[model samples]
Target: MKINDYLSHEELKRLISALLVVLGFISIAAFFGFTVVPGLRYQAYTTGESQVQAVQGETGWLDPTEYPVMAKEVIPPIDPKTVMTPNPALMARGKALFAQNCATCHGPEGLGDGAAGKGLTPHPRNFTANAGWKNGTKLEDIYKTLDEGIKGSSMVSYNYLPKKDRMALAHVVQSLGAFDHGASDPKALANLEKLFASAGEVIPNRIPVSRAVTVLCREYAEAHPQPTATTLR
Candidate 1:
């Protein structure tokens, strides 16, 4: 009953073979559960028609106004030869404008690291650091930015400003001493002069208040066709 009674070799072999079969089945089941099945489920979830339907439904009723206009106009070069000298008076005004509108994100010194700038994701431009994203030392580039803001960024159009005022602000920005282009390239200066000269002539005139008022009254009358005379008065 001692050693020989433990198990016959053939009996032990049969028991081991049965155990191997059970282990193989468990391994196969585990592989399918952990990898194949989950992958298939994920593919079905992502590639199903329901995904397209959900996207369509979400965007179908979007208003036209919800989409931003991405159009950009061609910009003219800043005439370096005709570059007006920095006017201290205009710079003072520009500084006030900067404080009122830009100081929140661009610091009081135009360093682009104001108090509010800290929370922004991409961060603001540090003007004092001399790292301009839209390059060119010409004042025209700065004017273009002020007129038609940089896209995909927080910079916005300041088109409400008069042309002269915008030019003044550009000068003030340049006066920060970061920009130091010596002189306008001779070729660029000649080209700018030619462009300006070839441009259509603009007539300067002032309409009388009486005539302007009449035109406005006529427009209002046309819009509200049946309005009483008292409404116009």
Candidate 2:
């Protein structure tokens, strides 16, 4: 039989008409998917979004009573005596902060031998020497040094660091000293106590450093719309 004999005229016409109907249906589907429907082709995106919202809502993140921020300590005035004790946990927390913020000047071993301190006038305090530290070797004294920094020297105030970090950093430095300068004299202790008392306790709800920096940078950009880099080539 001839290949043209496979379908009569009516059958051929019906087959071509069926194919046209299928193509038309596919075109309509493509048009609706690419241009008309919002998320019909995206796995019901709104439903998935609602699920995400449901999970976040169930986590108490939006609730006022969760108080997750309270877990972090800010520059809350701390007890000097407590900081004097060798707390492994506090020391651990301070290690990284010291390396990042202090080691450049103070040295990793607190030896006053850091590369940055090479030309500094007064020189960084050599923790192992145990001599002539402006603030002395006592806990409160060191905390004061960290908080207020020394004058007429390269040492600048680290008061911007949180109180907890300051205390922890104090301990990290103290741990480097050759000898614990046995407790401060009674008169000195009394003076330190009074000073700390004046500062009062500041209960911080939150003090996230990253967030603080981002906010500060945002403020800075707003203040200086056209900042110039004179030092950079």
Once model 2 is optimally superposed onto the true structure by TM-score, how far is the C-alpha of residue 54 displaced, in angstroms? 37
For model 1 the local lDDT of residue 105 reads 63
Q: Encode model 2's per-residue lDDT on 93-154: one tens digit a residue.
A: 66765665566667888898877677778887887777898988877788889778777776
Give the lDDT of residue 58 in candidate 2.
Answer: 15
What lDDT score belongs to each candidate, Candidate 1 first? 0.48, 0.56
Question: Please, what are the lDDT tens digits per residue for candidate 1 over residues 65-118?
Answer: 111112223334444334345555556656655554456566777777777566
CA displacement after TM-score superposition, residue 119 of candidate 2 (Å)? 1.6
Which window of 10 residues has the lowest lDDT sum in candidate 2? 41-50
Tell me the TM-score of each prediction against the true structure: 0.43, 0.49
Q: Roughly what TM-score does model 2 have, to 2 decimal places? A: 0.49
Candidate 2 residues lying further than 4 Å off, grouped into runs, are 1-84, 185-233
